[model samples]
Every structure is written in C-alpha cells, then in structure tokens.
Target: MSLARFLIVLWVCLVSAALPLNAQQQTEQNQPMQLMDGPMDNMLPIEGQRFRIDADIEEITLLFFREPNSQPLILIKPDGSKWYDSDYPLERVTWYTDPNFDMIKIVDPEPGPWQVAGRVDKQNKAIIVSEVRFEAEPLPKQLFQNERLKVEGTLYNGTTPVSTARFRETVVLDVLFVSSNNPDFDNFGADPTRVAEFSDNGQGHDEQAGDGVFTGRFALDVVPGEYLPTYQLETPLYERSFEDEAVVVEHQPVTIDFQLAEERGADNGIEVSLDEKLVNPSSVAINGSVSYPNGEERRFSVTKIDSFPHVIPLDNLAYGKHLVELTVFATSNQGREFELQFNNLSFISVEPVAEPTAEELAQQARQEAVRKAELERQQREAEEQQLIVNLIIVAAVNVVLIAGAISFVWWRRRSKRLNNDPATAQKNAEKAEQKAQKKAQKKAAKSE
Candidate 1:
C-alpha cells in the first residue's frame, strides 16, 4: 500500500480500538458524582458516600447552579482526612463565580477513593473556550481624522472558532467614541449610529462562516477623539465582556510604553519607547521629558531611528505620579509644518496617580454598603427556604415515629391477651393429665 493508505489504515485501527474506551470515559466524567441521592434541601453534611478516582486527572472542576449560589464543596481523602488546597505542593485550583457562572478547579488530584460533601447540580452550563484575541494587522497607529477605520476580533473554543455560529447571535462589539478635545468624563456620550455589526458569514473579506474571525469598519468622521472598543459574548453558557485598552483613536495617534526600572543599584527611572507612522523619519522632531512633582523636567536623548524601536531612559526620578508629554513637529508631504501635542500622559511610581477624592470615596462606601445589604437579603431568603424544607422533613419524620410507637404498643397488648385466655388454661390441664398417665405406664413396664 502507498504511504498515505498505510497511515490511513493505521489511524482507523487505532480509532477502532479507542472508541469504546473514550466513550465510556466521557460518559463517566459527564455524570454528577453525588455523595447521596436525595433531596438536598437541608444543607446537611453527608458522609458514608465514596467515589473512586481510577484515572489520572489534570483538573477537577465543580460548577454551581441557580442564582444566589448554593453549597460549597467539601472534599475528604480516603484516609479519613480533610483535603485542603494548601496541602498540595502545586495547586492550580481556583474558585470563581459571577452572575452567570460559578466554577472551581482542583489541580492534579490524587487517584483513590474520595468523598464530596456537597450536592452537585446536574447541568453546569460552563462554556467551553480555548482562546480569544483582538487583532489589528496592517492598520497604522496614526490615521487622519477623515479616513476609514477598521478593527478585527476573533473568538475561539478549543481548536475550533465560533464565527457565524455565534457572531451577532451572541458575540458583539460596541465602539465608544470619546471626544479628547473637550471630553465628557461623566457620560461617555457614545454615538449609537457608529456601532459596527461584525459578521463571519463568508461574505466580503470573510473566508468562512465558522472560521472564528469577525470584522467591523466605518469612517472616522465624528470629530477628533479617542475610540475605545468593547467586545461582549452574551450566551446562555457564559457571558463576559472585554475592553481593548491598547488601541485608541486620535488625530496624532501615539502609543507609549513606560516602565520604571533601577539598574546597577541606582534609583528607578522611567523608560519610554515612542512610535509614530504619519511623518517622515528624518523630518520628524520629537521632544519629551518626565515631569516630576518638585518642578523638575528630566529630558532624554531623542533619535530619528526608523527601522528599530529607539528606547529613551530618564533617570533619578523620585517616587510619585508624573506626567510625560510629547510635542511632535513634522513637515507633511504637502510641505505643511504641523505641530501636534499629546498631553496628560500620566504615570505613577510606587503609588497610584489617581487617588480617590473624598466625595468619590464616600460614594464608593455607600455603594458597597448597598451591595452588602442586598447580598445579605439574598442569603437570608435562601436560608429561609432551606429551613422551611427542613422543617417539613422533620415534621414528616416525627409523624412516622409516633405512628410506629403507637402500633408497637397496641401489638404488644394484643399478643399478651391472645396467649392468656380461658381456652388456653383448659388445653394446658388436659395435656398435663395425659402426660401423668404416660409416665405411670412407663414406670410399671420398667418394674416388670
């Protein structure tokens, strides 16, 4: 057979041998391994139920169901020891929950008999995911305000991407336009008409429906401002939203990377790398410095390096919030010398730059109080429901016990009366007289 045919035959044989084993394993894993099969209304600690872990496991996850959350999982080892996460040398287990989902992971579990203390739901509804990313290919960092703007995103589940299978049906992107010139800090005032609908239905530039990539684009004409993109996947299984903080829009689109690092036992300094694509390399004049709190502006050497990234270091900066701004002067191809200013580029060293104002702190406290009150209310309601169910069960058990006791007493009295009655005495007397005659006859025979 040819090489291709031989490989195909080998694959088929391997699959045929593994099919039953794979199916059985999957079925076992999917089933809810409960400690006991009964109503989990009382929230009582159940013992005596054991489950065996016969196979190697990389992770064991418990996903909770129903809103307001339910019981916490308690695990016990085969040697009658409580299993705590801290005991494991390398534990990747996590417990996280949201409004839509709750999940916990136990990493590298030992193989043996173990017991679960809490009841698990039948349906977990945790979404399957492999990876997700937002991308920008050949799009320039700097674009004119009147040009077209495009952005792309892709969502994945394991190796396969969920494109048109979800797309507008679940995955969505909402673009927020913020005016940088006179920005509104309270309400972002994003334009509803600028919302872009992305699709991967093999239309236009899309390669395939299930290829996982989604694209959206529109003209950048709503004044010169910063545009932030947010992506949302609202599904029954999982619901989450992510904002892309790396990309933004402005007339002089500039991106900066700042880090405070100390070298050779010296004080920390801010290292910055700047990139701008709109102007000619040799013609561009860029000047910037790190402004300190004590009215000190330390400058760094700027170069016209075009091929590789040029890093500039500003040293001996003290610990505090600092602002660094760049003023770019460039001659366009049309011989126009235009100067652009990027301001409020702030960074803090050792401490946060934007500390909460007094009023803001008060507002935060109020919100936290309200949130705690609501959580307590929900917990109380859950406890109330559980108590009611437990009370009903207890009442039923008491009734059964009382009925059993009454039946036992009545049966005891009836048994006594049946055994000691008038007919019983007469039968016993006749048996005794017969026994005496038999004994006398036996005695006479022995004498003869």
Candidate 2:
C-alpha cells in the first residue's frame, strides 16, 4: 500500500479510537491504565489465526494484510459472534477495507481472543493504540544554511516506547520544515519543504533498527529563513505528529570578498571573512581554485588561520573577469563543524592606471630635446637660404648700376670725340638745319 494511504488509515484509526467509550465502563476505569514500563507489551501473541486483547484496552485497532482480490476477512468475536464489514455495530465498531489490507477499530472492545477467517499475509501485524504520542527534541533557536544535524525522536504509548520490531517495518517517520511566514524573516511566504525522514534501520544516522528511537539526519540546505519544524510518525493504524518551536536559519557563516590588484605587477587579494558570533575563526579552512580570464586556473589552500579577514594573494593574474570557487570547513561557535561550498563567485580585474617612471620621463625629455634641435637646424637652414637670396639680389643690382655708369661714360666720350672732329660736327649741324627748313615749309603750306 502507498504511504499516503497508510497514513490516512492510521489517522482514521486514531480518530476512531479517540471516541468516548461506554459511560459505566469509563466511570469504573476512571484513570486510563498506565503502560509505561518497557517496550510496548500491550500486544498479545498470535496463536494460529487468533489474537487476544486485554480487558483494560478501551480501544483496539487491528490491521490485517491480505492477498490481492482475497475475500474480506470475517471477524469472530469473543462471544462466537461473526462480524463482517457490512454487519459491524455502527456505534462501537469501525471497519475499513482496501485491496491489500483491512483495518478494524473497536471501541470498548470485548477482552478475549478474536479469530480471523481468511487468507491473511504471513507478515500481518496487530497494533494497539493507547494514548499514542510522538516526542522529539526542540530544534535550536538558530541554525545555519548548509548545516547538517542529527535529530532523534521516539514513539510512545503513554510512557512506554513502541519497540515492536515488526511495527517499525510498517511505520513511517517524516520531518517537514514549514515556513513560519513571518514578514520579518526571509522565509516569509515560502512553501513547506520536506527536509528529511527518520529511520531506525541502523542506516545513515540511525544507530539501531527497531530500537524505537528514530533518528533523522537533517541537512539544512534550504533557503535561510524562519521555519517551524514538524515531525510526524505514521503507522498502518495510527499517526502522531509533533510541531517543534520556530527556528531561524541564518546565512552561511563564511563570506568571500575579492580585492583587485591596485597597481601593475601587484598581486590580487581575496579576503575571506567569517562571522565570529556564529563560527570560530581559528577552526576555519578555505581551499579552492581560481580561474583567470585567460582560462588558466590555479588551486590553493588556506589553513592554520588564526585571525579574521584571512587574506589570500593571487599573483600574476590577467586583467578581466576571474572566477573563484571555494569550499569552507568551519566549526561553529556551538561546536558543530560543517563544510560549505561557494560557486559562482567572481570579480572583474581592470588594468591599473600607473604614473610614468623617472626613466620614462627622462626618455621623453631626451625626445623633446631631439625634436627642438631638429626644429633649430631647419630654422638655421632656412636663414642661410634667405641670406644667399639677399646676396644674389644685391649683386644683381650692383652689376646693373655699374653697367649703366659705363654706358653713360661711353656716350660722353663719344660726344667729346665728335666735337674734336670738325667735319663730323659740321655734318651733324647741317642735317639739323635742313630738317628745320622742311618743318617751316610744311607749316606755311598748311596756313595757305
């Protein structure tokens, strides 16, 4: 049968068993019998197909597992009366049937041997419920994310533990973390989460099987928030649930901060800080791999730490986005040690702006001097070219003036030679006088 169906059957059985018994019988047994001595002894041994119930039991729940499609089992009461599913007394008897099991709850049941007539499974068990309750330790007021805890609980009938080996086989113990929905907390409006199930099979966190002390290993891996823990114990015939006090699950106690290199050729710094109020700083160790932007990765471990803000230096890291993945092993102030993982931690490294060094400044100064010298040389060459052009102009002017003076002197010497020669001078004067007479003749003709 499914665990859900079993839990339903158990709940119905418990509710039916809780109904009041006969008034006279209740008055006689004013106080319920205290079965607080040892492992549950209320269950009597089965002989053949019959089991006996004691007279002290005001309510009894009997469960029988049958083969598939088998006929409904017939219950033969202590008075030799037969009771079937259709013919049980409505007020005092409740019967439930399924394909694999039949559950019967009897209130103020007759104290005697009852017989079952049908094909019953060999492993069928009879569970008696008397003041059944589930008891567990209250969760701590504060918890940390990724914390693992071992919690123990016990199923009791009055003051005695339910130690039936066969009962454990059919019982289911579960723990659920329900959000407290406090607006002031992080888990407000969060859905309920089933974190762990209790086990008694000597597995994981359980020390022994069928010892009635159920153990559950709870891993607080859910979101850090306020929650109310509920522990439930379920059996084929009854279920008991207990709600623990509210608890706040704080964030992981360790945090990581990356400080990029401030200057060229400087080492990058990773500062790991821990909450001393929650964990012991001296007991913490961090180890992880750093993936640089260039796809190169280096692994490192930090131990023997005795102070807060444990700094780890990463040298020669490239500039760009860098990924840091780490795992922290820390012991809490409460002395509970746990391991936490931090993935997806990353930071960007930018190249630093550095000032020019003295050598670089000197080189710049030398370059400037060379540039100035080149400019001066170009200016000097231009000045020399201008001086040469000025000299050529002066020389050309002086040559022209000297040539004119020579020409004037030659003309004066020629005139003097003409005067020295009479024939030449007389021929020159006659030519001048004949030219003047022709001009006079032309002027007189024009007047006429």
Candidate 3:
C-alpha cells in the first residue's frame, strides 16, 4: 500500500482500539493535540506538502509517521540547508526515531517553509513547545471550610490566548489541595485532595463556553488546615503543573447556641455568633431551615444584625431533636466576602417537670403532724421502761448491802464470844509455845 494509505489505516486502527464510540466523538476535536489551525494552514500550502515554522516560535517539534524499518527522516530548512538523522548531536537540534515515527526538535528554527524528504506517512504533526502556559488568579488568603469560590484561569500560547473551542476541549485544568505538612495545621500528613476542576463548557460557575477563560468552582469543604494549592494543566501531548503559596483554611465563622424554652409550650431561641476576628459581625447574614422531629420544616432569614450574638426566636417548639441547616454570607475582616454552609448544626428540646398542687401540700403537713405525735408517744414509753429497769437495779444493790452488813455484825459477835471463852484462849497459847520450843531445839542441835 502507499505510505499515506498505510498511515491512514494504521491511525484508524489505533484509534478504534483505544477508545469506544462515545469517547471517540468526545476526543475527535482533541486528536490534533496543540496543533493550532493557523500554523497548520500556513504549513500545508497548496504548492507542496510542507510545514512552516514562524520566527516568533522559540522551539518546534515535528512528528512523522512512517512504515516500520523505513529510512531515517530528512529535514530541509528554509535556507535550503539539510539536516539528516546522522547530523544529530548538533547544537539546537534533537532527532529521535522509532519503528513507527520520527520526532525532530529544533530550537530557534528558521522561519519559513520546511519539508521532510522521505516516504513519511501523511499523519504528521508540528508542535510548538515551551510557549504554552496556564495563568490563574492567586488563591485568597483567608479561606473558610465549606466555602465555594469561583477561580478563573486562562491558557496562553506565546502571549496569545488559546480561545479555540476545539483546543479548549483538549485541555484539562485541575486544582489539588496537597497538605502543606505543617504540624500546626489540621491537615498535616493528610492525603492530597482534588478540590476543583476547571471547565470552559459554560457549566456551573463558567460564564461562557470557549471564551478562553477557564472557571474552577472550588468547594473548600476540606478539613480546616494548611494546604498548597497546586494547579495542573494536561493535554494529550504534554502536561504542566504549578504550585501556589501555602494557604490556611480557617474554621467555619458561624457558631450556634440553642436557648431552649424555660418551660413547656414556650418559644425556643437560637443565638448566632460570628467570629469577629475572621468575619464582620454587621455583614453576616444567615438563611437556614429548621427541621423538627415531627417532619416539619421552617425557613428563616436574618439579613440585618443589630448587634453581636443575634438571637433568632423559634415558635411551636418540638419535643425532640431539631436540625438546623444554615448558609452564612459574610465579609471577612479583611473585606473579602464569602459564603459558608453548615449542614449538621442541631439541638434538642425537652419538656419541663410540673410543681405539686396546694391540696397535696396540705396532706403532707397532716401526715407530718400525725408522725410527730406517734414519735412522742413512743419516746415516753421508752423512758418509763428505762426508769423501771434503773429502780430494779438499785433495789437489788440495797438488798445485797443489807445482807453484807448483817453477816459482818454476826461474825464480830461470834468472835467476841470466842475470845471470852478461856479454854479456846489456852489452846491457842499452847500451840504458840510448842512452835517456839521446836525452833529453840533446832538452834541447840546446830551448836552441838
């Protein structure tokens, strides 16, 4: 087959194998990755099959598809100078060849018609390099969790905006929040989070389609912490990434406190407080819905705040948990305005206990009086019993004393009668004299 026919068949086969039908439709516009129409039109003139390189282009790369094992490509510059594959290692030129294609890169290329003299397939492309850039607005300094922001960016090719709709379709711009690894922040060691993807499809946050301005709807719903906002632009041929300075996402600026009704059937109140250090109190506006346990919802809005700790009164309070969903719009203390969402705010309401009636109090008093009288009667009976026990003890002691005295007197009289008896006295004296004679006989025997 002819080289062009072979290249066309190969291209079709490669595309068919790589993508499904629906994806092919979506990618048809992007197939000529970074191949601008002006350059392509100027390069492919009617006179001959040659490409052009403009003077302003700092560098250009040419891709030529050829049959496997084909001879190396031959490039003819505008000055009729020829550069061969063997002429590699030359300054400002790089040539690489594979089984299917040859890629040549030239720096400061001559600005005129250039031709490839070889049996190269018709599927060739020229890419302008080192001139494509993505420029974006700097992320705000004071960002809050759950804040939605619209950031705009533009793709530039050598100071010219890449506004072609087909070219825009080939570009993918994404924003990622990579943890700054600052120990002072909450997101330290956290995985990188993709927060937004830029689009030019005139969809959410995008003002218009293919106007060259790419809009990124950033939902800062990540944990309040430090992050390095990184932007990446990717196309089928090349990719570029940029990192902005680190930013800290502050905590939500609105806090809620519920002041439930003091008594049952009374209105409940909610106190909304704003962080004055982060947000302006007067500029804060709250719009929310209260979902009650009984499946009823009430919407409220507070546009004017007369003072701090603004109170919102809630009527027909429910007896169970009530959920509060709020969207706060406020200007930061630095004058940057933003909106925040607080979905999980909630509180509970309870019923109060009732007081007793007058009749119940009177009955309690009567019961106390009867209890006091019974206690007095029981105390008197206990005192009488204790008195009788003490008297019995005293009487028993007296009887024992009287018996002891009578016994002592009778013994004394008996002793006096015995002393007056002479025979008893003489017998006592004779026993004493016998004990003394025995002691004197022992003394005399010790002397002998």
Candidate 4:
C-alpha cells in the first residue's frame, strides 16, 4: 500500500480498538462484575478479550489488555482494594472488576489512560477503584501566519486532557515606525504600502476550536520601524503570561508561550490624566500637554469657565477646591478696566497685560459724573429763563391791549361824531346825561 493508505489504515485500526475498550471499561465501571452464564475459574474479559487473574487469593483480581506499547490496565474489587495488571508496580492499580465482569470502582485521577483491577470479598458484595490515578498537562503553543496570524494550543491537567474548558487569547500590537532621518525615509512621509495591515482575528490573534485549541492571526502591515506584539491567555482554572514582560516585537518575529499560574500584585501609584473640556469659544474636549519641572510633556485637559469673575466650576475636581488665579483680570469694580474690547452680552473675563491705572480710572469716573450733573443744571436754568420770558411777554401784551383800548375809545367817539347821523348822536348824549344825573344824586345823599 501507498504511504498515505497505510497511515489511514493504521489510524482506523487504532480508533476501532480504542473505542471498544473504552466502552467495555465504562460498562464495567458502572456495575459489579458477575458470572456470564457458565461457571468459570480465574477467567475474565479485558477489553473484550479474555485474561487470567493471577491467583493471589488476597483482596483483588486484575484485567490486562496489551495493544502495542499502551499502558497495562488493572481492574479491582468492590472493597476498594487495588490490583495491577502488571505486578511490577504495586501501588498503581485503582479500579476493580467482579465475576460478571461489571465495574464496581471509579476514580477521579489526572487525565490519561487508566488501568483496571478486581477483587473478591469474602462474600464478593462490592468492588472499587481505590489506589492509582493519572494526570494531564497543558498543550504547547503553536504559531502560524497567513494574511493574518494564527495561534493554537491545548489545555491539559497533568497527562490527561480536559474537554470543554473555556479559554481566551488576546493579541495587541505596539506599532513601529521608521524615523525621518532614516536613509530610506522618503520626503513623501505617508506611504500606504508601508502601513500596517488590519485584521480582526478576535482581538488580533486566532480562532478557537471546539477541541480547546485556538488558531487564528491578525493582519498587520508592519512599518519600517520598531514595534511590539503581545498575547494574553486566560482561563478560570489557570492564568499565564506575565503582564510586565510583555512581548517585544522590534524588527523580528518572536515565539511567545504562556502557562497558567498565580496572579501578580497590582500597580500602586495614582494615575494622572489631563483634559481640556472647558475652554473659550469652542468648548471642546481637547488634549493638552502637562510640563514637569524638567519639561517632560504629558497630556491634560482644561475645562470651560464662567464670564466676568472668570470662575470655574471646580466642584467635581478630583483634588477638591483650589484657588486658581487667572492673571490680567478685568471687567469689574468702580475703577474697572479691560485690555480688550469684549462685547459679550454677559460679562467676559479676559486676561489683561496690566490693570488700569487708578488715576486714569478715577478721573474718567469724575468726568462722567460731572458731565451728567452739568447737563441737568443747564436743562433746569433754561427752563427757568423760559418761564420769566413768558411772564414778561404776557405783561407787555396786557399793557399794549390797554393802551389800544384807550385809543379805540377816543377814535370811536370822534368817528361816531363824524360818521354818526344827528339822531344817533343825540340818543348817545341823552344816555350819558341820564347816567351822570343818577351818579350826582348818589353823591348828594352821601354828603348829607
């Protein structure tokens, strides 16, 4: 047969043999072993094949199946005593078998292939797997790269493998870039070809399979500069990878592995962040740099402020209330002065180069008051003069009217004499004579 055909045949045989053995072992584990119909002496089934229990009349019997180099199995009694398929290792046998070939013992051991042993009590009532156990170990890390990256690994406990345990893997890249001074660095700075490719292989790593092996990769077009790559593995049962010693990817590929271990202590120092939430005009979230005494630059934020007094609502400030004096203060008080012509409907706070001089401010104030008072006094004096002029005009008009009345009287008498008919003049004289006679009579009575 061809090499491929031969390998296929070998695999099939192994699977078939292993499966039946597992089933039989499981069945024997579920019940007490009993006689199968006929009476038999020292003969029992092992992996569906017959085996002879070496006659140690003490506590247990053993079942052994050999398939190439596989570990020998031993089944034991219901009393919890152990027996080994091979006598070489005395303490290793944990499971027991009965006459009917039922399993009366069970053991929670490390993950791996297990052996079976049997025992006969004085009455042969029960059997158990009491002694040996196996253990499994974690799988090794496998790395692969395609258009993206792929990673694969298994989880095990000692020699046995655990099924269906949740595992998570994460990958992150600290991007690298070439300096402008580099010889190959072109003046045309941003080259799309040199940019890193993108990948979403679940947090920059690989896909996980039902078998607990993770496999996938991230797409990255690494630039012509230094960069770092890291991966984290986590599970409820185990923790691996030291956070401090993160994977460093400078210019080359590095193989990284992780194992579950105990947790490390956390950071102790406080973290300071800078924000620029409150600034003028365009109140926005801005990133600013904080300078240390040595001129080290760090990011920070400066929030917005109220007008006039230039007060900031520092109520929620992390460090509590603080007196932050904004220099060049202006726009308040009697001698108030501002550096710039601000026309905010509300009061605005502007940084001034220097405060207004006291003399200039006082002089301006006095001038304004004086000008207002002079305007009022002028208005009052003008009103009073107008009243006096109106009174004099009234008196002159009265005197002129009285003089005109006298002239009118003289003109009327003369005109009446000239223009009046004789009869009309005689009537007027008669009325006047009557008026005089009445007045003369009153005067004589007063004299008496």
Give the winner by TM-score: 2
Q: Give the TM-score of candidate 3.
A: 0.51
Which residue pairs come into collision in candidate 1?
Answer: none
Residue range 1-448, candidate 3, lDDT tens digits = 6999999999999888878876877766333222335643313221244666666877676556565578877888778888888885478988876665666677787777677787665443333434567888998987999998889998876666765454465568899999999999888899988999998899888999878898998888798999999998876556788899988899888777889887767888888887788887889888989989899999999899988788898875568898988888999989999988777888888877766689988998999999999999999999999999999999999999999999999999999999899999999899999999999999999999
Q: For residue 182, give model 2's deviation from the true position in Å.
A: 3.6
Query: Which residue segments of model 4 deviate by more than 4 Å?
Result: 1-357, 365-384, 411-448
By TM-score rank, best first, the candidates go 2, 3, 1, 4
Cα-based lDDT at residue 285, candidate 1: 57
lDDT of 2 at 72: 82
**Cα lDDT tens digits for candidate 2, 42-104:** 553333677666778787676666776788899998899999978989999888776766778
- Each prediction's Cα lDDT score? 0.54, 0.79, 0.79, 0.35
lDDT of 1 by residue, 39-144 (tens): 4311212223345444555555443332235544456766767744334333465655444334445666566777655454433322223233334233343444
Clashes of each: 0, 1, 0, 68
Indicate the residue-level lDDT of 71 in model 1: 44
- Model 1 clashing-pair count: 0
The parts of candidate 1 lying over 4 Å away from their true place are: 1-139, 158-168, 179-195, 204-207, 236-239, 245-448
Consecutive 10-residue window with the lowest summed lDDT within model 2: 29-38
Global CA lDDT of candidate 4, please? Answer: 0.35
Q: How many backbone clashes are present in model 3?
A: 0
- 138, model 2: CA deviation in Å? 3.5
